[model samples]
Structure formats: C-alpha cells, structure tokens
Target: MELKQVIEILNGNVLTPSANLGRQVKGGVGADLMSDVLSSTQPEAVLLTGLCNPQVVRTAVMADITAIVLVRGKHPPAETLQLAESEGVPIISTRYGMFEACGRLFQAGLPCLERPVNGE
Candidate 1:
C-alpha cells in the first residue's frame, strides 16, 4: 500500500513532510524491540512501534524501512525526527496503540512480515 494510504488508515500526523509519501510499502512489522525489528522486518515495510528514539530511526535506516509510525499517541524527540528526516525516512504519529494500528493496516490489506522458517 502507498504511504499516503497508510497515513489515512492510521489517522497519523506527518512529522517529516520531506519524506516520500508516494512510496509504496509492501508490508508492516510492529515491534518495540529494535533488535526484533532489525531481525524481522522486510525491505519496504512500514515499522509500527512505540519506541520513540533516535535508535529507531537508525534501525529503520539499517533495515531499509521507508516509513515509521509511532503508536499510542507517542512522539519522538526532536533529534529522532531530525535523524529520520536526514535518513529520508518518514515519521508518522498515531493515536492507536501498536495492536490496533497493526490490525487496521492488516484489514486495509497491508500484510505483516512472515516468520522465518525455523529461524531460517
């Protein structure tokens, strides 16, 4: 789904307007643990999390995630937003919790990453 559609679905606020909202995200991965995100997320996926830190942006960059949605009405620090913008990653904030946000996206046809087969 397109990033614009995901934003609409989640009722999110665009923290970084410079991001490519037209880009398509193939799937999503909701996790607060950066390690799990790094290990599980797929290329072009949107990361849904409550972890509002610069590390989240760094992780997104390392994982090639194009967008991030901060759940549960949480907002990241200025530095985090700055880092995300510099990395060309869009940061979105949503009132929905992680589970609700994930469910909404899933219902809207945004699939989640599949678990590796026996840890690959």
Candidate 2:
C-alpha cells in the first residue's frame, strides 16, 4: 500500500512529509513501546503507535519504517515532527485507536511480515 492509501484508509491527516505520500508501505505493525517496535518491525512497514514522542521517530528510523500512524488522535511534539521530517519519514495522525487502526490497514490488504527464513 502507498502512504496515500494509508492516509485514505484511516482518514488520517499528514502532519508532515506531505511529499512522501507516494512512498510504498509493505506492511503494518502496532506497538506502543519503542523497544518492541525496534526489535520486531519489518523494514518498510507502517508503524502504528500512540506514543507521541521524538523517540517514536528514532525507533522508526531504526526499524526502517516508511510511515508512522499516530493512533487515538495522538499528536507528537513539534520537535518530533521536525526529526521525522529530517529523517524523511512521513507522520500521520488518526482518530482511530491502535486496534482499529491496525484492523483498518489489515482489512485493506496490508498484511504483516512473516518471520525470517532459517530462524536467523
């Protein structure tokens, strides 16, 4: 799914990186803890989180997530947005909660990533 598709699916507002709407999203992962996200998220996945902090962007960078969906209408601080912008990651906000946001993306055909081969 493209970032624009995610925005349309969640009725999300792009808080930053409006130019990144064309970027492709390969999957979605919903998590509140940055450590969990860093440990498990697949590259190019969309991160669905309610944690409104700069660390969210840092985690996204570590995980190589293409976009972030701020669930429950949560808004990150301006500094967070600035960090995301500098990192070239798009930040989107939605009124839906985490579960609903994940479900919406999943139902729209954005599947999660499978475990890596060979049990690396």
Candidate 3:
C-alpha cells in the first residue's frame, strides 16, 4: 500500500509537512513498546503506536521503518515532531485505535511484516 492510501484509509492527518506521501509502505507493525518495535519491525513497514514520544521517531530511524502512524488520536511533544522532521520521517495521526488502524491497512492488502527477535 502507498503511504497516501494509509492516510486516507485511516482518516489520518499528516503531522509532518515534509513527508512524502508517495513513499511505498510494504507492511505494517503496530506496537506501543519501542523495544518491541526495534525487535520485530521490518524495513519500510509503517509503525502504528499510541505512544507519543521522540523515541518513537528515533526507533523508526534505527529500524529503517517507512513512516509512523500515531493511533488513538495521540499527538507527540514538540521535540518529537521536530526530530521527525529533521530525520525526514513522516508522522501521521489518526483517531482510530491501533487495532482498527491495523485492520484497515490489512484489509487494504498491506500485510503485517514482523521479524523474530532471534532473526529466525
């Protein structure tokens, strides 16, 4: 699925104006824990998390994740937004909870792409 489709499907708003809506989203990973995300995330997958923090963006960078979807209408602090912008990571906010957001993307043909911590 394309990043733009994710925004439309979830009724999301782009928090980062610099975000490229044309970026390809190969899969999805929903998690509140940054550690969990670092452990299981796949490159180019969209991250769905309710946690509104700068660390989320940092995690996305480290994991090579495509974009971020802030579920449950959560908004991060100013630093989070600034860091995301500096890092060139797109941040999107949606009123839908994590589960529903994931469902919408899954229904749209975006599979859940997660890796085992053990690299299995």
Candidate 4:
C-alpha cells in the first residue's frame, strides 16, 4: 500500500512531510504503546497510533517505520512533527480508530509482514 492509499482509506490529511504521501508502504502495524511498537513494528510498516507524543516519532525512527497515521482524529504535537520531519517519517491524521485504521489497511491488501525479533 502506498501512503496515498492509507490517506485515502482513512481520510487522512498530511500535516508534515506532505511529499511523503506518495511513498510506498509494504506493511502495517497498529499499536499505542511505544514500547510494543519498538518491539514489534517492522520496516516499511505504517504505524497506526493515538499516542500523540514525540516518543512516537522516536519509536518510528527506531523501527524504521515510513509513515504514522494518528488514529481517532488525534494529532501529534509540533515537537513530534519536527522529529518526524527530521527523520522523514510522514505524519497523517484520521478520524478512524486504531482497529478501524488497521482493518482498512488490511482490507486494502497491506500485508502484515512478520515482525522478527531483530527485525533484520
């Protein structure tokens, strides 16, 4: 799934790194706990979360996640946007909840790639 498709699926709007909306997403992961994301998120996965904090971007960086979809219409703080901007993780906002966002991506054929322990 392309980042543009995620925006279309969740009716999201790109708030930062607008140019990244066309990036390709190879998988998806839904998690609110930053620790869980760090443990489980895969490269190329579009992270779906309601956690509106800079740590979210930090985790996205560690996991190499390409895009972040803020679910339930939640938006991250400016600091988070700055972090994402610096790290090149595009941020999008959507009214859909976490489960709904994940389902939408899955229904759209975004495969759930297995998360290896090392995520190599």
Candidate 5:
C-alpha cells in the first residue's frame, strides 16, 4: 500500500508537508514503545502509535520506518513536526485509535513483520 492509500484508509492528515506520500508501505507495526520499534527488522514499514512526540519521529527515522500513523487524532508538538519534516519522515494522524488503525491497515494487506528472537 502506498502512503496516499493509507491516508485515505485511515482518514489521516499529513503533518509533514515535505514527506513522500507516494512511498510504498511494505509493512505495518503498532507500538507505543520505541524500543519495540527499534527491535523490528522490517524495513520501510509504517508505524502506528498513540504516543505523539519528537522521540517517535526520531525512532522512526532511525528505524527506517516509511511513515507514522498517530492514532486518536493526535498531533505532535512543533518540534516533532519540524524534525519529521527535516528528516523526511511522514507523520499522519487518524481519528481511529491505535488498535483500530492497525487492524484496518492489516485488513488492507499490510503485515507486521517482527524479527525472530534468539534465532527462534
């Protein structure tokens, strides 16, 4: 799914104007914990989280996340927005909560690919 399609599916608004809305979403991951996001090996995945902050943007950028979906219609602070724009990370806000937004994305064929633990 493309980022544009995700916007329509989740009824979200793009907070970062410079973001590449046409980028393909290879997978999805819902986690408020940045540690969990960092642990995932999936590349170019969209992150769905309820926590709206600069750290979220930073972690997404570091994790190479394709985009961010802020649940419950939450928007981040100006610092977060600025960082996201500069980092070229797209941040989207949706009216649906984290669980529902993630489910909708999954239903739309975006899978959450978590890395195996301890070579399991």
Candidate 6:
C-alpha cells in the first residue's frame, strides 16, 4: 500500500515534513523491540511501534524500512525526529494502539511478514 493510504487508514499525522507520502510499502511490522524488527522485517516495510526513541529511526535505517507509524498517539522526541529526518524515514503518529493500528493496516491489505516454513 502507499504511505498516503497508510496515513489515511491510521488517521495519522506526519511528523516529518520532508517525508514523501508517495512511497510504497510492501508490508507492515508491528513491534516495540528494535531487535525483533531488525530480525524479521523486510525492506520497504512500514514499522508500527509505540517506542518513540532515536534507536527506532536507526533501526529503520538499518532495516531499510520505508516509514514508521508511532501508535497509541505517542510522539517521538525532537532528537528522534531529527534522526528520522536525517535518515529519510517518515514518522507518523496515530491515536490507535499497536494492535488496532496493525489490524487496520491488515484490513487495508498490508500483510505481515511471513516466516519461512523451514523456520529459517
């Protein structure tokens, strides 16, 4: 789905003014643990989390994530927003909780990453 669609679906507010809303996101991953996100998320996925920290932006950069949705109406710190801007990661804020946000995106046709059948 497109980032613009995500913003509309989640009723999100764009915190990064420079972020492009036209970017396409292939999938969605909801996690507060940066390690879990790093291990599981695919490239160009949108990360949904309530963890509003600079590390989230760093993790998004490392994972090649396209966008970030901060659930539960949480907003990142200025430093975190600055880091996200520097990394070209768009940060979005939503009033929905993590579960609700994920559900909304899923209903909107964004799938979660699938684990390999071999458990690799």
What's the lDDT for all of these models? 0.91, 0.88, 0.93, 0.85, 0.89, 0.92
Residue pairs clashing in model 5 are none
Best-to-worst ranking by lDDT:
3, 6, 1, 5, 2, 4
Error of 1 at 77 (Å): 0.8
CA shift of 120, model 1, Å: 7.7
lDDT tens digits by residue: candidate 1, 1-114: 899999999999999979788999999999899998887778889999999989999999999887999999898899999999889999999999999999999999999874
- Which residue pairs collide, candidate 4? none
RMSD in Å for all candidates: 1.3, 2.2, 1.3, 2.6, 1.2, 1.4
**Which regions of candidate 4 are displaced past 4 Å?**
114-120
Q: After superposition, how far is residue 91 of candidate 5 from its true place, in Å?
A: 0.5
> What TM value does model 3 have?
0.95
List clashing residue pairs in candidate 1.
Answer: none
Residue 108 in model 1: lDDT? 94
lDDT per residue for candidate 3 within 1-120, as digits (tens), equals 789999999999999999999999999999999989888888999999998888999999999989999999998899999999999999999999988999999998999888866656
TM-score of 6: 0.95
Q: What value does the lDDT take at residue 113 in candidate 1?
A: 77
Better of 3 and 5 by TM-score: 3
Q: Which stretches of candidate 2 lie over 4 Å from their true place?
A: 114-120
lDDT score, residue 49, model 5?
Answer: 92
Per-residue alpha-carbon lDDT of candidate 2 for residues 1-120, written as tens digits (9 for 90 to 100): 889999999999999954479899899889898877877777999999898889999888888989889999988899999999998889999999999999998999999853344577
lDDT value for model 6:
0.92
Index of the highest-lDDT prediction: 3
